[model samples]
Target: MDAGILFWKAFCENGESELIDLTTIEASMTDSVVATLPVINPSTYTKTISSPVVVIKSEYRRYHHALKASNEAMPINLLYGWGLIGYWGGVMFLGTLWKVGQWFYYLRFNKSKAKDIEKPNQSSQGELALPKSLAMLRHWILLYIVIPATIGTYHQRLFWWSNIPNRLDSLIVFGFWALSIILGFAGYDTFSGNPTVTSLPEQNWEMLSDRTAILSYACLCWLWMFSGRNNIFLWATGFSFQSFNIFHRHIARICTIYAIVHSIGYTVEWIVYYPKYFKSLKENWFIFGIVATIALSIMLGFSSVFLRQRSYEVFLVIHIVLALVVIVALFIHTSYFGTQYNGYLWPTVAIWCFDRFLRLVRLVYCNFSVFSGKAKTTNASVMYSSASDVIRIDLQPTASSLKGRPGQFYYLYQPYTLRGWENHPFTLGAFTNGFEDSSPNTPEIVKKKVTTTTTAQLSDSSDDAVKLKSYRSSSLSNTLTFWIRPYDGWTKRLRNECIKGGGVCYPKILIEGPYGHTQMLHTYDSITMIMGGTGIACAVPYVQDFLGKSKIAISYTSKIKLVWTVRQPEFVEEVCANDLSAAICDQRIEFEFYCSKKNVPTNISTSVHSSDEVTKQIIIQSGRAPVASLIAESGTEAKLSNSRAAVLVCGPAAMADEARAAVHQALKNGCRTLDYFEEAYGW
Candidate 1:
C-alpha cells in the first residue's frame, strides 16, 4: 500500500476533524508509492472519528495517483501560512527585546554624565538629577523600543493624513496608504483566510504567495522616495531619533516583516499542495537565497548604526557589502525562470544606480582638478596693523594674483612660513589689473623664458595655447588678494609668522575655494552695502566693479554708500590712506566711519550717552570728511525709485538678519527694487 491510499483511509475515518489520518489514507490509496508513503504516514496521523466510512470513486491506481497529487500540493499552503505570521511576529518581538537590553546597558554603564550632555551656548555647570546608570538605561530603552513602535503607528496615521494636502502631495499620500493597506490586509489574509490559490490538487499557493511578497517589497522601495509624505509620521513617532536617519531603520523593519510573509506564505502553500517539499528549503535555493539576503542586509544596516559608530572603517565596508547583497537579492527575487514574475521594478532601480554613478564622476573630476593644481607659490607682502589689530596686507600679483570679487572669500594655505594644512577663509580687500612687481616678471619676460622652459599645459590638448604656468599665473593671481583677521588656531600662527620675519620666504599658499557670491550686483542699479570691522572687504568689491566701469550716472544719481562701524579710528585712516582713497575721489561714493571709543568728528552727528551736555551735535568735520549725513540720508529710496537699489549684505548671520529686515522695511516705504542676500560663514 502507498502513502496516498493510507492518507485517504485515515482522512476518511477522521471526517470534519482537526487532525487528519495520513497512514490510513496513504495505505488505502497508493500501492508501493515513492512519495509520502504509508510507511511512516500514521505515526503523525490522528482521527476525530466523526464518520466511520466514506465512498471513494477512484479505486486502486487512480486513487493512489490522487493521494500523491494531494501530498505534493500540501507543502505550498503550509509554508505560506507559517512564513507570513512567523516573520512579522519575530521582528516585533526582537525590537521589544533589543529595547530591554539597551535599558540595562545604559543604566549600568553611564550614570554620572547623564546630565552633562553637550548643547550649544549653554553653561556646563548644571548637573542632571538622575544618576548616570539610570539615565543610560532610560536613554537606551527609549531609543530602541519606544522609538520604533511610535514611528510605526505614526507612519500609518500620517499616510492617512497626507490625503488632505495639495493635489500632488495628497495623491502621493493617498496612493501610498491605499497600497499599504491593501498589501497589509492581503498579506494577513493569505495566511488566515482560504489559503488555496487553485482548486487543482497539484497546484499550490507558492506562486501566489511569491507574487504578493514581491509586490509588497516593491512598494516598500517606492516609499523611500517620498519624504514629505513620511515626514509627519517620522516626526510623530520618530521624535526620539533624528528625521534624516529614519528611512534605513524603517525599511529594515518593513523588509523583515514582508520577508517573513514570503517565507511562511510559500512554505504553507507548498505544504498544502506538495507536502513532500515541506521543510525542503535547501532544495529550493532561489527562495532561500532571497531570505538570506534580506536577513543579512537588515543586520548590516542595524549594526552599522548602533553597535559600530566607533568602528567607522568596519561599518563602511559592511554597508557596501549589504548594499551589494540587497541588489543581488532584489535581482533574484524578481527573476522569472519559468515562474510567475515581472520585470517592471528593474528600470526604476537602474535610474538610482545611474544617478549615483554620475555623482561619483563629478566628485572625481572636482577632486582631481584640485589635486593637479596643488603646487606651492611664494610671495612677500607688508602687513601693517591698525590700533584695532586689523592687518593691512599689501602684495603684488607676482606673489599671489588670485583675484576674487568683493565679499567672496578664499581658503588661504601658507605652508612654508606657518602651518599650511589649516586653511582659513577671508574676503578679498582690493583688486588690481596687474600689480607693480618690486622685481618685475612681465608677460614679455615670461614669453622669452618659456622658449627654454618645459612645463605641462593646463589644457589637455597639444594645440591648446594655455600652458600650465600661464594658467597658474591667471588662476593664482585671481585667487590671492584676501583680507584675513587674526583669530584662534591658524590665524594666530600666521600673525606670529608675519611678525617674526617682517615677511617669510617660500610661502606655499593653496587656495581651496571661491565661495560666497550671494549678491547679484548686475540686478541692481544702486546698492548700499553695510559692513562692520573687517566686513568692509565684502562690501567694497562690487562697489568698485560697478564704479570702475563708469556705470555711474550724474543725472541718474546712483549713490554707493558704505557705513563702516569700526572699533578703532586707524581702520578709517588705513582705508582713507589706501583702498578707498581713489574711490572717495569720485563724487558718487559716500563713506562713513563710526569710531566708537573717542568723540566722533564734528562734521558727523554725535549722540552721546554722557553726563556733561545733553546736546546732540551733527558734525561736518574735515580731517577726512566723514559722510555721516550721506550715510543717514534717504538716498536708498530716492535711488531705488530712480534706479534699482539692492542691499547686498555680508557679515555675521545675526547682523545679516537685522540688516535684511531693515532693507525689507526700506523697500516697503518706497524703494522700487530691493534685494537682500546673506552669506553664512558657519551656519
Candidate 2:
C-alpha cells in the first residue's frame, strides 16, 4: 500500500476495534504499493478492513451521523423559527405595552408632577421619567424606522447583487428581505421554497438570488449594529443588567452566528460546486485563507466578550494581533490572484486600508516637514515646564519635526539623548518664534552652557544645523513646543531624576495616533463644551478651530463657555493674560473660575470676574461641576414638554450621570431632544 493509504488506514482504526496496526504496513508501503493485501484469520474477519479505506457501512456510524444531523437541524430550525416569530411579536407587544404604560403613568404618577411644573421654582431635582406617548413613539420609530433604515441602506449598498450591472442583483436582494419581513409579519410560511416565494422571476433569477444573499448579510450587520447601540445606551443609563447583556453576552452571540454562517455556508457551497477543489483545501491557498480567517474569527469572536471583560488590556493586545491575522487572511482570500467581490464590504475594507496608509504619511510629514524646508540648520530656544513646577528648558531643533493638533499630544526626543526615538505624549501648550534680538549677556551664557556640560554635547550632524535667528515672531516660528505634566511613569521618573541633578532630560520620542476629535460640529446651531481639570486639553484644539473660522454664535446660550475650577485665581489671571480667551472677548464667551482653596490670592488684573457673567449660575467644587445649575441655566419647561433641543455632555462618568439627570429633567418639563457625547481614551 502507498503511504497515503497507510496513513488513512491508521486514522480509521481505534483501540476499541480489533484491527492490525497500520504501522506494520509502513515499511512495505514506503518503497512501493502492494499488489495483494494480507488476509485476516477467521476470528479476525471484522478487522480485515478496519481502516477508513474500507467502505463497508456500519450501523453504529450511520446512527451517530443521523443523531448529529438531527441535533443540528433541530436547533437551526428552532433558531430561525423563534427569531422570526419572537422578534416581530416582541416588538409589537412591547410597543403597545409601552404606550399603555406611558398613558397610565402620565395620569397616575405625573399628575402631581404637573402641579409642580406650573411652579418654575419648584425644588424637585430628580429627572422625570419619559412620558407614555413620547417614549412609546420613540421606541416605535427606533424599531421600525432607524433600525430598519440603516440596515436596509447597508443592504442595498453591501450586497453582491449591488455589483451587477444596473444593480439588478441588489434590488432582488433587498426585495427578498422586504418580502421575508412582510410575509413573516402576515403569518405566511417564511421558509417556503416555491419558485413564486423563494425564487425571483426567471428573467433574473441569478441576480435575484445574489441580491437575496446580500440582503441576508445586511440583516446580520443590522442585528450587530443595534446590539452595539443598545450596549452604549444601557451603559449610559446606568442599567448594569442591560448593559452587561448588550455589551458582552449579546455581542458574542451575534458575532458567533455571523462567523459560523459566513464560514460554513460559503464553504459548503463551494465544496458542492467543486468537490475536487474542496478536497484540496489544505493545498489551495484560497481555501486555506478562508479556513485561517474562520478559525481566528471564531477565537476572537468568543474571546472578545468573555476573556476580554476579565483582563481588558490582555484581551486588547490579543484582539489586535488576531485582527491583523484575520485581516491578512481576508485580504488573501479576496485577492486570490485578483478578483473583485460584488459588495461595499470588500471595497470599504480596501478604502479603509488606503486611508490609513495616507494618514500615516501625513503624520510623518507633520512631524518632519520643517527638516526638509529651506533652512538646513536652525537654532531655537524652547521653554517647557519642568518637575520643579518652573517654566525652563531650551532646545536647538536642527530640524522641526513636531507639528500636531491642539488637543492632541506628541512624544519628544533629541539626538544627544539615550535614544533618538524615545518620546512621550505632551500637550502643545504654546507656540512662538525664536527671539531675534538676544541680549549681549545671552551668548556668554550660551558659551558657558556649552563648555561645561556632559549632557549639552550634541552629534556633529546636529551641531552644524544649530544656527541662531535675530527676531522673535510667533508667526514665523518652525519649532513645535509642548507643556508636559509628569505623572508616576517612565517620563516622569526620568524628568525628576534629571532635574534633581540640575541637568536637562532630552530624549527622542515616537508619536502615534491622532485619530479622534469632535465631530458633527456643524450639525447644531449652538454648542457648549464643559471640561474638568486636564480635560481642558481636549477642548483647546476644538475651540481654536471654532474661533479661527469665525463660527462663534452670538446668542448668550449659543456661545462656548469655558468653566474651569482651579486652586488659585492667579491661574485664571495667567490664562486671560496669555490671550487664551482673547478671541471670545466681545464674542459672548463666559469664563467662570471657582477657587477651591479660599486662602489663595486673587491676582487677576483683567476686568473679568467670577461674578461678572456667572455667579449664582455656576458652582465649583474639588470634583465635577454642579449639574443642577447647568440644568437650571439650559433647561426649559416648554422645550422639555415639546422635545426640541439637544444636550451633549463629555467628561467623567460621574459627571456625565449628573448632567444626564439634569438634561432628562428638562426633557420631561418640555426639551425637544437630548443628546450626549463622551470620549473614552481606549479600552
**Every candidate's lDDT:** 0.42, 0.38
Say what the RMSD of model 2 is.
18.8
Residue ranges of candidate 1 with Cα displaced over 4 Å:
1-386, 391-403, 416-420, 435-479, 502-506, 516-523, 551-557, 596-636, 639-642, 681-683
- lDDT tens digits, residue span 1-683, model 1: 34544574555653544445555754554433443333322223375445323323333444454454445443543444344334433433544565555455345323322332232212111321245586456445433322222222222122432211222223323443454445444432121212122343223245445544654455333333221222223222211112223433444445555566666666665676555454555544556455555655466355543334344435545655665565566556555343333343464365456545644443233223333366333343535252345544443332233444545554455555534334455666665544421111212111111121322221112121122112224322322344566665665666676567543323434544344432435334455666666777776666556555433221121557666665544455444433444454455666565644444332333222112222222122333212223322343654334444545545543454455445444444544334444443321
Candidate 2: misplaced stretches above 4 Å? 1-256, 261-295, 298-320, 328-349, 370-528, 541-560, 565-588, 593-623, 637-648, 672-683
Candidate 2: tens digits of C-alpha lDDT, residues 243-297 = 2222333323333444454455455444553354456566545675565446555
TM-scores for all candidates: the values are 0.40, 0.44
Q: Roughly what TM-score does model 1 have, to 2 decimal places? A: 0.40
The deviation in Å at residue 104 for candidate 1 is: 64
Best by lDDT: 1
Clashes of 2: 30
